[model samples]
Target: MALKWVKDNALNLGGSPDHITIFGEGAGAASVGFHMLSPMSRDLFTNAIMQSSSPTSYWAVKGTQETSARVATLAASVSCPVSLGDALLPCLRAVDAKLLTDQQWTLVNRWFDVPIGPIVDGAFLPSHPEDMLKAGDIKKTNVLMGVNLNEGIFWIYSFAANMPLDKEGATDKEQFRNIVLAIADNNATLQTELLKVYSKEFADAQKRRIRILDAASGDSLFKCSVVDFARQYTELGGRVHLYSFEEKLTSNPWPGWMGVLQGYEIEVVFGLPLNNGSTNTQAEKDLTKEVMGLWTSFAKTGTPEFGEVEWPMYSTETEDYVKIRTKGTTVARRLRSHACAVWAGHQFP
Candidate 1:
């Protein structure tokens, strides 16, 4: 769709890249991850960067048929589920502008029911992207994979900002809590399992429990899948570079700790920069230069490096990845191990 949109409307400004890069941030990164492994998307791009995303390695639905059924109703109501035969999608798009203005926050979670998404029909998106990735069917795309620290807290907080927390209505704080609760509730099993894991680390206070849950879920959902993506790519003799984003976070209303919360790099990526105010002045400049070297190199050469140090590809055997932080970048052990362990243990088929 990304390329097609460009093509369909005469976006062939200069024609395709001899090595076009298709990548995304968050779920958008999942699209990049899929492109890395998909035969359909192969010729479209030769390089991929999957930032802060890992497809369904974080959480898998038990009954997508039921989920699809629910989505189909919405699609039918809007005369959506567009295809060559289906003209009603245009009507739905007309409703889209209105829906954007009038739709409830809850509807955002119902994005699956909408026509535009990763379809499970086994046609376009055939299987889980990770499945194809691990089986090593993915194309040879130099890949970038990693997650932002505290990636989930803000997203969960933002998503839950409209819930009717007190029955009468939503206060700002209450709404935020509601979003957190709703998400935690939706993935109750994962939440419950995480609490069990984190209890070993921070054993008291619901706040601490929630924080721990955020960390674990952040790992399992986004972080691990990235590592897994690199693992598969490296297995295929493909080039891969992985990094963990850990720019010290800005101060919060709460007194003590600062944060590197979700999507913060979006502003940075857009060249809109801010300081988290956590580290010293020198550390800040160093880290900025390091990250710039990475992404810019990846963008330009499909290889991320500063000078003599070329970014190494990740291999399950070698178990190495870059730790992107407020200090500088350094290779570390296999990333998101706990996340991989959790998912592997759960889906043992």
Candidate 2:
């Protein structure tokens, strides 16, 4: 319908139908990636930009069983029949919108699990998105994809109260392994391997456990998925541009230890005011212009060109991407490659 409207009335609305760019951040980015895969969405857009999320990310999808379980929970919360008999759609629609939303949030706010997400219904998405990308089923549109430096820090800190951080703000081996296991779908073997990697690398006292786990979470849940998708998509002959936002956040309202947590790039990318409610700094302004320039340039053309760095098309050989920072941006490769390798076949839940 969106494409139909654009085709019929874009010119009348003073927009070019042929130049549409589907842009999304986080979950919306996952949506854009799906559109890239769907045959129905082919040729609907000429370009796509996905930030802070990827089709390969675990949180981007859920099995049908889990999705159905959440639906049953929601129905029970609203005092509707779980079976719904012949009134399934009506029963759901009859629940108060606010009540349904509150119930959904309650289910979603739990640590180590996502209560809801898109599922593979075997039509639009016939198989796992990872499989589709590897099969080269996605539309051959220009693509831009990336994640923040510390994407999982926000989740770890947000759920700190429920997590097993000790008194001095550290976690023991048991607590750390259990946390990883919860996300890994209770796969003990995978959690054991992850523990070995993180423990060997950050073999200090418990004091540094929080920081160590933060990077582990980011790599397992975000960064490695980004690498896998970029590599696989490129292998299938897709033109891809990758990035990692590593600007040490200066005006963060949270503790300094939060690093450059997830979604920080949205404000920077869209030119919004900084977290301190000030955008007067010349450096911030320059960084904002550079990000927007690259994005808009990709929308108009099919490539990103910003500052002295000409963002290269992603390939398995270089595996390079533009790293955004306040000082300057440069090309980097294989972020946390060692930790990412431990998570190669262990993505679960």
Tell me, by TM-score, which candidate is best: 2
Error of 1 at 208 (Å): 2.6
Q: Per-residue lDDT for 268-327 in model 1, tens only? A: 453323345433356555556667667777866788877555567677787777777665
Tell me model 1's lDDT, rounded to 2 decimals: 0.58
Give the least accurate 10-residue stretch of model 1, judged by summed lDDT. Answer: 249-258
Kindly provide the TM-score of model 1 when superposed on the true structure, using C-alpha atoms. 0.71
- What TM-score do all the candidates reach, one by one? 0.71, 0.88
Q: Candidate 2: lDDT of 60?
A: 87
Per-residue CA lDDT of model 2 for 109-164, tens digit only, reads 33555667799988767788988887889988688989888788777755555653
C-alpha displacement of 339 in model 1, angstroms? 4.5
Q: Give the poorly placed runs of model 1, Cα more than 4 Å off.
A: 1-16, 57-68, 75-87, 100-116, 121-123, 159-193, 202-207, 249-258, 274-286, 307-311, 347-349
